[model samples]
Target: MSSHAPPARTHLLIASLCLLGLLSTTGASLPYPILAPLFAGDVGNGLSAFLGLPPKLLLGIALMVNPLGLLIGSAVLGAVSDRLGRRRILLATAIGAAAGHALTAAALVAESYPLFLLARFVTGLLEGNGAIMRAMVVERVEGPLRNHALSWLNGAFHLGWLVGPLLAGFTVGVSITLPFTIAAGALLVGALLAASALERGTAAAKAGERWWRVARERHAFTLLRHAPLRTLFSVHFAYACGVAAFYEFFPLWLVDVGGYAVREIAFVNMGMCALMTGAALFAGRASSTEPRRRASIQAGLAALSILAVGFGSLGVGLAAIVLFGLPHAYYNATVQGWAADQFAGYGQGAVMGLLSTTFCLANIVMALAGGALALVDTRIVLVLGGALALWAALAMRNWSRRAVSVAAQAVELR
Candidate 1:
């Protein structure tokens, strides 16, 4: 008999994790649709204007706070899971995240800005369960099976992005916080699913060490001490910057250039996300090795640059928006698989965490950079995104040469 369990068991495990991804991300995204309206100086003045800051500025801070928390959490939580068992940490975080959402609901009801920010930060922190999920997929499912599992997981996440805002939009009319409470309940369901799928034993490494000591010493950021990882981080960060720019500003491009409104923009996003989800289902079958994956990423970045530039005009923009999802799906799944394979010695948890942290940092940096550029021209910001993508591709090509050189040197030494 093969050492692996039955294929059916693997399928069930993947299915459970996908459901977990879908549910947790649904909860994570629930607050997004509501945030714009809340801080636009209309529904909740007391919360928005607490420090007498401009509502727009307050909105920016509110948005930044969650991802900032997520950046820290993603770097820390995954490393924690490497020491602790996956299920226990994930389960605790899920329950804690539900409480965070509840706290957000309470803050909304109370109209307290400080409380609201606190709730959002904590919620984002717990939402770092994403790193845990990715690590679990990479660790449990081996060989080609890993790719299929991750594709479905990524697909489930994309579907959640589509599902969450719609759910929030529907419930916001009833009460501002109703969607958040619903989100909490959804997360609990996800926790149950994760519990069913995950293995129970803790890692034996540094077995008696303090949790904080482990987290402090072995988190994803610690990976940067190595020269190769620094190169990997640079390429990933640059590519992520391009992605973040497009993600943050493309809607603005539609608004400013194409004269689209909220509902129309939402429709475009719906189509894009739907395509992304579908593409993710097929991304694993793309016939990829590390070199091919790198080439595909470069190609995808170049294509994204073109799409970004062409996306300002209404007719082409609509097509560009929807078409972006296909390559995006392939890019995400493949990069993840590549990272897991390349850095398994670092611990899959920490590797996955580093990727999430990189993305979140890119989002933050791009949002700030794009916001400034948008003031000049939305089209200009979109073009900048494309330029960054091209730069990232160039960087990737250059890095591959150095990687080959290093390999040749190692062979000579041996």
Candidate 2:
């Protein structure tokens, strides 16, 4: 019997998931690049003083909730996707994210710090969209397309970050509430579209199995035993912790230390977005035929960028932000693709969920550390972040060698 080719709609399905992933990330990150200014002023300050706290501490209180929610969401909802099907969980996530954003808008109007933080945390609990989208794309697409799809998804993530903060900056003075409202609307539409457009569970092996049972399966831990898998998890953990810590402190450094305006800050972020998007696009093009070399290049770029951040020369900070964002896009795509390759035959959703949970936990630890460190010294945070990135680079070096050998043998077999 001749093998049946995948349906033509596969590409369209993958692309739609990418767009949804973009929306999910943008909605989650919309607050980050502008949190200091948005919540540090008159209204926010009143709330801070009433709550008996410093402005940055108040911000940290709000910010800490997001990663905590993400950590929980990735672990719980991710497993939900494994049993409930990708479409159901993604749609539910969209609804949850939209509701969270709406709450943010309401909180902005009310100027309530506690409510605002609650909204952000609830929104964050819906962060499984990215992992679900990745699992969907890699599962549906084959060969080079799978690698390309992941790279493009990573690129889309940067695009969301690019759009979210820039748009938030434009609206901050006009109305901080406005950005939240807009984000809410966008997510609502995305959720609706995903529900109608995406397929669900046609080929699921244990469709009738309870979610908890599937969640406890041995395969999840089995995948972790693989060396490459462990390396990817390490890289995600270190890089996320470092980046979260640096970003937590970066804006304060710029305002209190650098004396830059909101627009200037936004422009600096744009530089990171540009480099990140560019690298992701470049890496995706190379993922299929040369997964190993691509991994090495990503690791090299990451290490260089981290070094640049720590060099501590005049104007180096500005240069470092751009450099730091450059390598992450590719590194994320390559590692995620590597994970997909490991579970090439079965249970993609479960594996993706397990990996995402690790990513979220790393962010949670990093955010907590970031909050604590900012109380001490922001400069120390940057230095520590750079060191972690360097460590991730070394780990990636080992993964690259293994990837290269795998790619070579696969090619030779052909």
RMSD of each: 2.7, 4.2
In order of appearance, the predictions have TM-scores of: 0.92, 0.82
Residue lDDT tens for model 2, 1-414: 011226666666766777788888888778876686655766544446546777877876777788788766665665556556777777878888989999988877777877888888888878755667777787667777777878888888778877887678677778768888888888888777767667665434365677656555533444567765676667756766666656656765666567888778778878888888887776665424455446556655665555555455538777877777767777777767876786655457656766777767766676667657867766667678767766666666666677678879999999
Give the Cα-based TM-score of candidate 1 against the true structure: 0.92
Tell me the TM-score of model 2: 0.82
Q: lDDT score of model 2?
A: 0.70
Q: Which whole-number lDDT from 0 to 100 does residue 190 have in model 1?
A: 73
Q: For each candidate in the order shown, give its overall lDDT on alpha carbons.
A: 0.80, 0.70
Tell me the tens digit of each residue's lDDT in model 1 across 1-414.
Answer: 012336776777788788878877787778778888888945657878787888888888888888888888899889888887676777898888889999999998998999999998998888887888888888777778888788889999889988989999999999988998998888887778767766565564464787688789988999999887787788788778877888888888877777888899899999999999998887776462455346446445545644554454577777877887887777788778878888888888888999889989999998988889888887776777777666767777776677778889999999
Candidate number achieving the greatest lDDT relative to the actual structure: 1
Ten-residue segment with the worst summed lDDT in candidate 1?
1-10
Q: Lowest summed lDDT over 10 consecutive residues: which window, candidate 2?
A: 1-10
